[model samples]
Target: MAKPLNLLELIPKRIAKWEEVEGLVVILKPKFSHPWMREHLLPRLKKPYYRVKLDETGSSVWRLCDGQRTVEEIGKILSQNFGEKIEPLYERLSYFFQMLERNRFLNLTQKDQSSGQ
Candidate 1:
């Protein structure tokens, strides 16, 4: 997993399909964290779910992780929509993505690491 970046220039991808369940974003957890969980006991048992409830601000930011927009771009949109500056914008956004990434919700994508922009 990527560490909490000092900047938010990387692209991100959702790990799996998620759905809004009663206003919460929920993802299905595979039956097994280890292969043995599936093979030893719950081979046929249904998978459980992981739900993340987002407040207004988090929901707005979460909705923007469409696997295409760079985190910086999303920060700009947040600035425009909210009509105020998000100082240390990239750092905050990077932390958000890093949390999600660590929890297996998403991952960042970067093609050009040398771009200092």
Candidate 2:
């Protein structure tokens, strides 16, 4: 049997700071550590890092990560926002989320049990 989808896992949310720089909105976490710190310094440096550029759609999705909403919720919202072109919206949003996770722009957290109000 195929494994059941974990709703929380599928649409995890995280807190991130957003900035508009050079005509692009950048998303980043304030606590990410540098890879070269431990080897170069006696005490590892824990400076803030900003490395991801948020496109229009990405900026929209990033704005929705206000400690609320699930992946499914965001997907539905995007679907409605895009109307007949929902598939592309869904695909883009999913791709953006995956990229953010991979680049450590934010840390994914399980959705709370309570449905968003």
Candidate 3:
């Protein structure tokens, strides 16, 4: 029997952010309260932690998470947007999705079918 499709196996299209540091775009999810924030804030407020060091492809994948697109949808978008006709789009997307999942940056949540909010 064929393996069931795991929605969580797809790349996250949300909760991902990226910023360029030293010419390399670092992708990460910012924490709401970082441990080190107490030292920097005048009132000792907690800062969010940031996970950095994402590659160019990872960064690209992160940008596609607009809440409306799914893994299959993203593959199509990437292929069309980047003009990647020769290469396999789904395979590449799956690779990046796996990487993001391993890093704990992407969270898989059930899609709300009703109201589509």
Report the number of the highest-lDDT candidate: 1
lDDT of 3: 0.61
Q: Could you tell me how far off, in angstroms, the CA of residue 72 lies in candidate 2 after the best superposition? A: 1.2
Candidate that would win on TM-score: 1
**Candidate 1: C-alpha lDDT:** 0.69
Candidate 1 lDDT tens digits, 3-72: 6643466787788557776665555555456767657766565554444666555666777888778887
Error of 3 at 79 (Å): 0.5
Q: State the TM-score for model 1.
A: 0.67
After superposing candidate 3, which stretches have Cα over 4 Å from the reference? Answer: 1-3, 6-11, 21-24, 29-51
lDDT of 3 by residue, 1-117 (tens): 986766533435555556677656676554544546534652443434465775655556676666666777666766776775526777676676777777666754446659663
Q: After superposition, how far is residue 19 of candidate 3 from its true place, in Å?
A: 1.8
Q: Global lDDT of each model?
A: 0.69, 0.62, 0.61
Error of 2 at 32 (Å): 8.1
- Ten-residue stretch with the least lDDT total in model 1: 43-52
Off by over 4 Å in 2: 1-11, 21-24, 28-32, 35-51, 114-117
lDDT, model 1, position 87: 58
